[model samples]
Target: MIITKAKPIEEILPFLEGKERIFLVGCNVCAAKMKTGGEPEVLALFDYLTGLDYNVIGWAVPTAACSVRSYESLVEKNEKLKEADCVLVMACGSGTSVIASILDLPVTGTNDTLSLGGQIGSSAINHLCSLCGDCNIGDYSGICPNACCPKSQINGPCGGSKNGMCEVSKTSECVWYIIEKRMKTVQTLPILNKIKPPKDHFV
Candidate 1:
């Protein structure tokens, strides 16, 4: 799932400065799961904007605002959207961009895209994969050194890690250290001996 954080009101105010007849679009998937742009959130924002003397024409929480077809369907079904002079999308950057591309009016996002991560108990965790096109996590006990390591070290630790912590960020544990420990626990430490080819950044 894509992780996202809601933008503060101070930042969102600027986008609505001279705009009236606003329409809000929220996502029921990633944004909803994060409690950023769910149905309740969109309605609360609608009331807040109304109290501030802004004419909030309508609001909709689509199944997935990132989908062009879903958003287009909502737009076609809701005639009030045609009256909107501005659109405030409470989804990720991709959803906002897709809406903006489909609409002639000004479109803005109310959330900041954090990362392509997943939900873990009540928190979100960033994945080790950076989507580098060449996946080799299977060779390293399902951990990708390209993303977890600050230096993107694929072969092994840079020898700068001490006490299992990274030299670059003393507070964060070295991913290589975690990988090694995990491999040891699984009795697969010998797999680390295989040389990994350098990542093809162009991919």
Candidate 2:
């Protein structure tokens, strides 16, 4: 899941200021869960825009705004969008980009793309999981060293690790502590002896 927040209403109002018809598009995937640009949010926007004297023609919530299939369905269902003065995309930057590529009308982003991680709790906390396009967590005892370590070291605990905590902060748990415990449970502590080379930035 990607986390996003809606742009200020003041900034967004200018685009549809003099426009007669506006289409408020919502993404049902990430933005929906984040409470940014979901169906309810779009409806609220429509009401506000309509109250501002702009003619809000209609609104739609696509299953996944970034998906080509979902985008096609939205385009087919909302034929009125063609006549709209502009399309306000209440989705991540990628979703808005997709809308722009397919639509001739002016497309605007109502949200800012934050991260590619999912929700942790009440707050949409995301771990810095670097999707390097290749995963090596299996060799690393199911631990994502890329995100676990501040320095992103893959071999073993850094010199900064103290009492199973990171030197950066006492609240920060040491990634190597987690790796060691996991390796010990599986009797694979010998793997830690193997030194790993520095990460290839291009990779």
Q: Candidate 2 residues 89-199, lDDT tens each?
A: 999998999888887788899998765666667667554466665567777777778766777778877798888998765798888888889989998889777776666
lDDT of each: 0.87, 0.80
The local lDDT score (0 to 100) that residue 50 gets in candidate 2 is: 77
What value does the lDDT take at residue 126 in candidate 2? 52
Alpha-carbon TM-score of each model against the true structure: 0.87, 0.73
**Model 1: which residue pairs collide?**
none
Query: What ranges in model 1 sit over 4 Å off?
Result: 70-72
Give the runs in model 2 whose Cα sits over 4 Å from its true position.
10-20, 70-72, 119-125, 148-190, 201-203
lDDT (tens digit, per residue) of candidate 1 on 160-203: 99989999989999999999999999988999898987888888
* Model 2 TM-score (2 dp): 0.73
- Candidate 1 lands at a TM-score of 0.87
